[model samples]
Target: MFTWNFQYISKARLSSTLKQLNLSAEQGDILIRIHTAIHLADEAVDLARFVKELVPKAVIFGTSCMAVINKGNYALNRCIISVSTFSEATVCSEVIPIMDEYTGTVLPVDMLCGQIKKEFVRDNTKLILTFFSGQYKDAGHFVDRCNDFFPSVPMTGGIASCAQNNQDDFSDDGFVFNEKGWSDRAILVAALSGDKLENLSSFATGARVIGDESEITDTFRNCILSINGKNAS
Candidate 1:
């Protein structure tokens, strides 16, 4: 496994930095995850595209994130590329459409689980990394269902977050991008499988909340209309 955190300027500089990896000569099954806080869909796509062009055989996927957190530290307006090569494991990735285009309906979790299982044996599949758009409301449920289906396998990922728009609305601020393309209503999933594969480990930062908890009295959809009987700021 290898990771790079850098402030991306242009394709020329990106190419120079990527050369450090020697991806050209690197062989074996590989997966490249590109997470960026650039706040632009084009930037995310461009980054993924360049990496995929360099190693077309690798399973490349990622999304625009609010920030990059590594080893307990975090940064914004930067990009992170994580490359993992496996000689004993199998990895597959795809954009799972969670909502119907024409019908405008939220698809069931069954379809999502089907796609993950269809790529590898359910018993052998050991790890799953899923990236969902910030606008995707079903992300939480998706996790729950995956845990129900793949009881032994570990699942991890986060929402693709973006800054609020000028009007303070977050309707379409985030997206998921892969080698093929980017989408807002879909999710990117990578499934790994191998006889020796293990996904029992995980970690978190030392950050914690210290302020007093306030009671919420009312709510409007996902927003809080009032707290402690007072209007929410």
Candidate 2:
């Protein structure tokens, strides 16, 4: 088992980095997680293709990040690539499209949870990594619903984010991609299972609640309609 992290440079640099790892694409399977900044979004597809050529059997999964995080350092306009090669671990992933054109809404939380449970629940499964569109309005509710389905299994990941030059207008250009392709309105659930593989997750938030406590009185889909008996701003 081996894992390596790299900041995006160029295709040549990527080749050199992989060569330095001394990994055998022919002998062991590889899983790649790419977190890239919004400015580098256009290059992501090419990068995925390059990695595929380097390792024909590799399974690549990634999403755009508002800022790339690596080794305790945060960077914007950069990319972070994490590759894991394993000979004993079992990995599987499923992608579910979340768009609903009729209602102009994304998938409902209950339905999303049902699909994930149906596809990923297994006795040997150790952990699940989820990558969903950042444009999803109800990310918090989606996570809560996922927890309800697999309370015992650990889950971790982030929502895809894109760069927004205008603070008033948030862009919905973030995307998540895998071996199959990329999508802006989809959720990818990956499961890792095996006795040899151990999964660990940790999270940190920089925000603190300073205002008085308030209760959510009503909600419409992903929107907060009322708080403390008054209309939410």
Candidate 3:
């Protein structure tokens, strides 16, 4: 197995970063890490469009960050990307629709397990990575639901970061869509194994506080009316 890595450190206007990266898209696969330093949707769209234009054949997976870190420590208002080629790993990942009826329940678990079996075309999975949006969903609950389905598989990944109407550290909850037309609010699930994957690993970090810390005494479909025995509004 050969370990080849590519790092793109070029300076260009955010509007032209895509063009610059396209200049470097010469081989294998590309892993993208983007920081909008503003809105998650806006910055994500820029990178997604660039990926489609430059590395159309590469499998892209990444999250927006309040602080993006690479070989160094952490950074802000910067887009850091690391490209590596894996000749021995079989990587197949997908995003599923956000189920409205499967919150803090067992139904999502059952559905995910069945889907994984069908998607990867195998029931023997070793590692699974999942992420959910903090805006309209519960990340912890989703993780629990997934565990219920694949109790034996090693799973990791956390909720995506969210700032104000505009925050520098941000990433889309799921796959980038504005450019490639991905589901807007959905959960991303990836299953990898030594046989299918020559190698597999992942990590993430965030500083933006997502959602409210107050308790939800009562609510309905993205609207909460009360908290801690009192009216919220």
Candidate 4:
């Protein structure tokens, strides 16, 4: 496995780094995480073309982030690309569009869960990495359904968020890209299986709890109807 960090969005620099890796595209898959500030958002199609030319058979998956976590530190406006070559392990990915009707109502939780299970449930699956559009109103419920489906398998991912600067202004909506192209309202899931790869998952939240614990008593879709003895609202 090899990971490279680029502070600036430069196709020349990216190509140079890939050349240095001395890897063949047929060997493994590539995962890329980019900050939304980078102009790569404007030239994503061209970038995908360039990567495909380099590794025609390699599966490419990428997503935009508010900030990239690198080397135990958060980096702003940076791009992190990880290339992995697994001789004995297997890797595969699938993209599912968010189910939204013309009226903008999303599919029910049970239906969404069924969609995920139909696409990703497989034998020997060890790790699942997911990336979803931050615009989805029910992203939390979607994640909970995923967790319930794959309780034994480790899963990690986040909602794509726009870039922010010191002024706190956000720009450039986030997206996810794959061999089929990119979309702003889709979920990308990658599964890795085999004995050659070891996986560990962890998460951290910036919010701190200040009040007493409350039990969620009622819910409707993604909204909580009541908590403890009072209405959630």
Winning candidate number (TM-score)? 2
Query: Stretches of candidate 1 above 4 Å error?
Result: 1-9, 24-26, 70-72, 164-171, 205-233
lDDT of 1 by residue, 122-196 (tens): 678878888888767877677877767677778888888764222133226578888677887888888888887
Per-prediction TM-score: 0.76, 0.78, 0.58, 0.74
Best of the two (1, 2) by TM-score: 2
lDDT of 3 by residue, 1-233 (tens): 23322233443443354444443334433444333333356556656676656656655555444555546765555555544444444445666666555573333545655776567534546666565544435555555555666666667765556444445333443232334434446665666554555334565567776777867798754578888868878
TM-score of 1: 0.76
Q: What's the ranking of the predictions by TM-score, best on top?
A: 2, 1, 4, 3
**Tens digits of per-residue lDDT for model 4 on 1-233?**
55555553577877787788776646565554433444344455457667667767666777767677768888776666666666556777776777575765666766766776677766667788888866566777777877787677778877777666521443245777764667777787887777667777877789998799889999986689999968999
Identify the candidate with maximal lDDT: 2
Off by over 4 Å in 4: 1-9, 25-36, 40-42, 71-73, 101-104, 165-173, 205-233
Q: How many residue pairs clash in each candidate?
A: 0, 0, 7, 0
Flag the better candidate by lDDT, 2 or 4. 2
Cα TM-score of candidate 3: 0.58
Quality of model 4 by C-alpha lDDT = 0.68
For every candidate, C-alpha RMSD to the true structure in Å: 7.1, 5.7, 10.4, 5.0
- By descending lDDT, how would the candidates be arranged? 2, 1, 4, 3
Q: Cα lDDT of all candidates, in order?
A: 0.74, 0.77, 0.52, 0.68
